[model samples]
Target: MTAWAVLAGVAARLCALGLTASAAWLIARAAERPDLSALGLAIVAVRAFASARGVFGYLERLAGHDAALGRAAGQRVRLYRALAHGPLPAGSRGAGSGGGEALTHMVADLDAGQDLRLRCALPAIVAGVAGTAAVAFCWALHPASGAVVAAGALAAGLAVPAAAAAAARRLGARLAGARAELAARVMDLTDGRADLVAFGALDFATAAAERQARRLARTERLSGGVSAAALAAGTAVQGLTALGVAWAAAGTGAVTCAVLVLTALVALDAVQPAIPAAQLWVELRPAAARVRRVVRADAALPPDERPHRPAVPGRVALRGVRVRYGDVPALDGVDLDLSPGRSVAVLGESGAGKSTLLAVLAGLVQPGEGLALLRPARGLYQDAHLFAATVRANLLMAKPDAGDAELRAVLDRVRLTGWLDALPEGLSTPVGAGGRGLAGGQRQRLLLARALLADPEVLLLDEPTEALDAATGRAVLAGVLRARHGRTTVVVTHREDALGLFDDIVVMARGRVELHDAGDRQPIGRAFPSA
Candidate 1:
């Protein structure tokens, strides 16, 4: 399809040149003879060229856009699949962090790649073909005139555009970076609007956003100036080429001279777009490089295969586990053993690696210097997401083949059955993206219900009830423990009041466990002196 588009584009440009030359020839001949009847052939030829130019131009656009959009769709799917199966960087757990920015930037890069094919490659190919044919046609009229046209075309189409691209490359990169920064800042401000207002930081965020916008505007203006100057230079070369052709064809027949001069002018039209095409090529170079890096990264990973199922349920052990974030250790020399039908609650201050421990158990983060043996586990984190879908649809993610009875059973286990049944839509109630339609406690309960529906051998909960009140948190925790009585469960929480709910409690400080108590009679605060 793309090849046909290019061919049609070249044919359209040639028709444009032919139309200009034929019209000039007919006018010159009519002026000499003052007889329109004798120029029937020329008149018919002019009409044919004019009509074909419009028709082929439309076809070229239709075919080119179809091909480009098709490729874009394929690229998006490939990129998404690669990211899904690939190993993500440490500390980037969800799209709320820098992952969203990275994905958005990659998408923009893919778009730029498509634009390169459509605006740069296609135009360059058509211009080269048409310009070559124009030079050959001019030579047939007069060799000296052909030499002048060839030299001018080369200067206008190649030299000027290349220089313009070089000049705009740095500015284009700056503009792209500024645009990305502005978008990130805007998103950050929007996401943290309440916190920013409460902390009196909204003004600072607005100022930062304004600065990025100004920088982008300035870079774009400079790039536009460079393109305009290059275009002017190309136009000047076209005018000089037309005059040279006319001078070289002196003393020839009026019709012949007119055809050569007009063809020279029209041929330059084919080359005029080359300057912008070159600029776009330069601008897309960084985007191309980014896309290449992502593709290479994806290729380096092995293809995803089905995971091996666990032989037995409710067993998780980590020996001498350690994880580092740069020079600092997040988890240091940690060892844990979870037996079947046992519940362990981890209590820690902020940054005490409680969440990291849950992540390791969930297979999200790899230990640097230890061995981990875990059964199939389902993790419910504070940031668990809910898509803009119905309640039934969201629960189905945990068990795709689940029926209405199974869905209701899990919701009932999580104590959400009453509230959900009261809704007019019941299971069909629509939840907004990230559970925006639900309250914080409702979202947490919904996530718990989904995890219960999965029926995993091990369950990892990190601050699962943080959004609920103390009474509700205890009730929810009790219900969750009751529902998963036979599974090995790990819960990370800061609530000392709920410590009695677990069979064992582990207190952590810095990156190591400070105390471990069994039988659930220990005071949680006494184990952590710093807290």
Candidate 2:
């Protein structure tokens, strides 16, 4: 990365040299034109110089662009790693629904940052050097002419762009922030759209999204307008410098009218790279906070560190666990134990700490004042993600080298065999997000299949059936009941239908364990009290 940055810097300097040389040669050629033979000689020399300059210019972009991309890639990797760390206090977990947006900003927004670094900073530095050299070149021929063109070049490319960049810095940041925000909110809106529609809150959220879109468009337009204005100022400087050269050329010496034209054109070109750079910086201004947010978040955690993988497997226990979410305490001094070959059902309301409790168990959220242990095993909390990969792939995520027979058996037990085979790619076939490829039943079954495949000591299920139909739920419940014979499972649920699968029952209310039982009544309507 350091080497690339250095090479880019050198290229910027080379570009400056090329611009100055091209300008001097052009001005000289313009002055000598008139006699056909003499003009041809000058034109030929100018063409050769132009060709060489073009090559150098291309080289500058080639070397510099890669550096920018490489830097952006490094940042993306860093941010993604931090996101993986869990075990934070419950309130802070899954705080950002716009996670995709943050990732987008890190990669693309940072790419724009690279654009500014290469196109603006590198060239501006180069232009400053070239402007000075062009001034010296003209001065050597005619001192007065050199001074004016050199000064004008600085004003056009260096000074003006720099000033505009400073002014636009805040604007750039806002634009970047807005773009990130737009991306994040879009992700949030999509992820939460079902909830919104179901709750009849679509209009409110949609209006907010629309407002964000309008602001982004307006910011872009304003940025463009600023850039256009900056370009005009650069043009004015170049044109004036050229006019001065033309006047000086009339007095004909080593430099003339032709040289002045080249000087003006070269000066104008200096402004081009700065324009992109300035825009990038401007966009970055708004997103700086977002960048910091992602980069600095959970800074203590490194991306490569996996939570310690315990070799043994058996159960997960939350003992004297106290967890508070936001201003409300979700799990308060709750004591619970789930052992291998047993399952417990958690009962609660929407704000009844059901989800919060699951998060603690899964290592997604940490207990504020207690021990959450995977006793000789592991557990997955509710809100566990299913990547948009193959059904088999999702299952294999827990045990990558799981054999075909193992996968088939697990799939069969969960009753996903029919749906998994329906796909054209079969096992390799992709599943749509949140189970788009599979029916709601299939998606839930796939998640369950994954837990079974892992065969962890303890399984944590939170609203696991929210996406499944009643029939599929029964199959899943049956499978869990079967699973209970061999492993410990803790389920967070409000509905009593799934209760029969558990060997024990625990009810959490006001962050307290409202009810806990080991033996069941063994009554007929075991799953739920069929009213």
Candidate 3:
């Protein structure tokens, strides 16, 4: 596809050069009062070249955009897979993360990949081919004129573009930083709009956002000035080259001199895109780097390419596992083992590595030094995002082909049956971005419903009941355990009400297991009869 795009671009530029030279020859020859037949062929050549230029120009655009869009679709798929299944970069997990900033990186930064191909590589190749041909054609007719055209092409294509790229590199770093700060400020205002109003600080936050906007505008003005300078430089070279070619070919006939001068002018214009293309190439490098950091799983450590499944399904084992964030250890030298169909309740205080342990089991974090064997697992955390979509649409993410009955069943289990019936559109109701339209308890139950629908071999829950009252939390917890019977389940919680339902209890402190006990379990109906 790329090869076809380049071919069409070269053909279009050459036809444009042919049209200019033919028109110049016809005008000069007609001034000599010659017969009509003497100028017939030149007139025909002008018309044919004029028509071909537009045709090839259209083909060039069609082919180039087709190739670019096709590649973009494939790139989006790979990016989604990397974020969903592979190890994430540091500080990208847990509540209050900068999801808005990460979204900017995914969209704006990924676009840089497309620009590298469409804008930089395509334009550079087309300019080189067309510029060389123009110089050689003029040189064959008149050596002095050819030398003038070659010098002008080098100045416009090489020297001016090089200077533009250098200036852009210096300003591009500062521009990227400004854009990131602006995105963060805007997201905070949107997420905390209610609190800002309640505290009487809305005006202050708006002022800060306006300040960021003004700074971004100032940087953009500076970038525009650089582009204007490159444009002026290219124009100056075109005018000077026309004069030089005319002087060199003075001795030749008037008709030939006119053709040579016009050819040089049009050829210089054809390669003018080189200047901006070089600048854009320099500016897009930093954005491209951001995308690379997220897509590559081995950013911090070498990846273990071997499959990590245990000998039996729904079983997990970890020995001497350690994970460190910078100088601080999140999980240090932990050993654990769980058999299939066992339910374990993990109790810990804040900063006890409870969340990090869940991450390790879900395969989002790889142990820096140790052996970890696990099965496929699913986790339900408090911060799980709910996209701006319909209720049915959100549920379909877990099971794409799920029917209405299946969705209703899961919602009933999570105690959302009444809420669903109260909606104006029932299953088709639209939830605002991040579930802003729902109450805290409603959002928690919706996420729990999604987790129940997934039903993976191993279930991991991190403070799943933190948003509800004690009684409702107990009832919801019981329903989940009852549904997940005959599977491996791990609950990381501080509540004591659900302890009687688990077969084992584990206490953790300072990244180490402080206690472990194999206790007897009561029947689910006896413990939580109301469930």
Candidate 4:
């Protein structure tokens, strides 16, 4: 995309043009048996041009790839930003949210976009300039030969490529979706391999993956066939052009005729890239369209124009809020208020809307009716992911600028101080993906440490101590509540050990609050409903 890369491409192409022309001239002129001294210049010229061609080509590749990669990096950032706000790419929501399908969009689709600039546009521009110059050079030698070369260049550079592009355009429409489907299928098999084996459904998943692969292969085969046809047509055109030039130059001397015909043949190289470039352009079109759809969809969403409700730090209020999924309500007519520097415990069985209430307060889910006002909030879900990185790296994700002391403090707050000191690399110790290397309790603690690092105005924890032993769970919860003292915190928990730490307790049933009690007034056992 950079001007320097384009210039380098042109220079490289011109060098190729010169190398072929000079070599042809040298061979033809040497046949006259002229003085060895005269032949010396041609020999030197041939070598010089040949070497310069490689040098310029290397430079072109270096500069071109650098430019393409840089542009792709920036485009990737834009794509992420768009995806973050946009309607997520297909298969990037709910179950398997970021599996193979999203990976295809992020990686393969972006690669196709980069190919548009690096392979399609750059080659086409260089080919046009160098091929035109070659045509002009031929015209200087003889008008008839020039006419023949121009026609051949047009056929090779435009006509054949155009035909290929037309065919590719239709196939490309299906190619992007097919690739994504295949990736999703493959990822499904991989991610669910253990479960599939356990359930004896591995063969079924494999069969499905094979079917997708076949579909994708069929589309690719068709595209490859088109490219092959275009390549053959371009080669035929090159041969015909060389014959025409030779015939047109028959009246001229043998040396001149040889030069004209050979130049015409070699010059076709400059135009040759157009065939592949056209096909590449066609392939890129679908990918570009998909990316644009994501970005445009985000743009189409109405801005958050809701007037701000007057609220202080950590204050949250929901007035007759309701949320539903089809016929089932997750939250219904729920009215509650959370003041600054207060803590609440939300207790309920499954499907009682405890988690949904936290979702509302965190602004992750919008209520279908009534008002829900909240300040900045962060939630530590039960399924928080720990990346396959160092302890420091994982913690830094919550607060990027956090120093060693800050990280240590958060770890201490979550009662991981002894564990942190035991690690061979201390903060630099690496953890496995999804916390594979760490115990269940340690993973939960590490995630809690990350959530607490930011010390948000409002903290929401959805069953944070679910994975720990009863004793450890109680201790960790106590430590977390102590650290979150004087801050608004809402915790979803079934455990009764940490009840006294909260200012209030909310008990819900069937999406409605059944009881609201001050923590100190009610017996912990009575707070929960009888079966």
Candidate 3 global CA lDDT score: 0.79
Model 2 — which ten-residue stretch has the worst lDDT? Answer: 85-94
Model 2, runs deviating above 4 Å: 1-62, 65-230, 240-268, 284-298, 301-349, 352-408, 411-443, 450-460, 466-478, 481-490, 495-531
lDDT of 4 by residue, 1-531 (tens): 888888887887777777777777778878887888987876887788788878888888898899989988987887665543222433222222322245465567778878888889999998998899889989998999999999999999999999999888878878878998999889879777989999999999999989999999999998888889899999999999999999999999887898888889877978999999998887676676666555453342234311122236567778899989889999989999777777788887789998888877754565688666654333233336888899999988778999999999889877899999999999999998778789988998898898888676677888888888878888888888888857777889888767777888888889999877864545654756632
Q: Cα lDDT for residue 498, model 4?
A: 72
Give each model a TM-score: 0.61, 0.55, 0.71, 0.56
Best by lDDT: 1
Give the per-residue lDDT of model 1 (tens digit) for 1-531: 389899899999999988998899899999998666789989999999999999999999998999988987887786675444332333332322323455777788889988988998899999999999999999988999999999988998999988988898777668778888989999879877889999999999999999888888888888888888999999999999999999999878888999999999988878988999999898786676666654454242233311123434566667898999889898999988777778889987788988888877665676788766654433333337787899999989878999999998888776788889888899999998788889888998998888878776677788888888888888889888988758777898877888888888888888887777786465666666432
Instruction: Quantify all predictions' global Cα lDDT against the true fold.
Output: 0.80, 0.64, 0.79, 0.79
Q: Give the TM-score comparing model 2 with the true structure, all chains together.
A: 0.55
User: Which candidate should be chosen as best, given TM-score against the real structure?
Assistant: 3
- Of 2 and 4, the candidate ahead on TM-score is 4
- Clash count for each candidate, listed in order shown: 0, 18, 0, 0
Better of 1 and 4 by lDDT: 1
- How would you order the candidates by lDDT, starting with the best? 1, 3, 4, 2
Candidate 3 off by > 4 Å: 29-48, 76-116, 141-147, 166-176, 183-194, 247-256, 282-383, 386-443, 457-460, 467-478, 485-491, 494-531
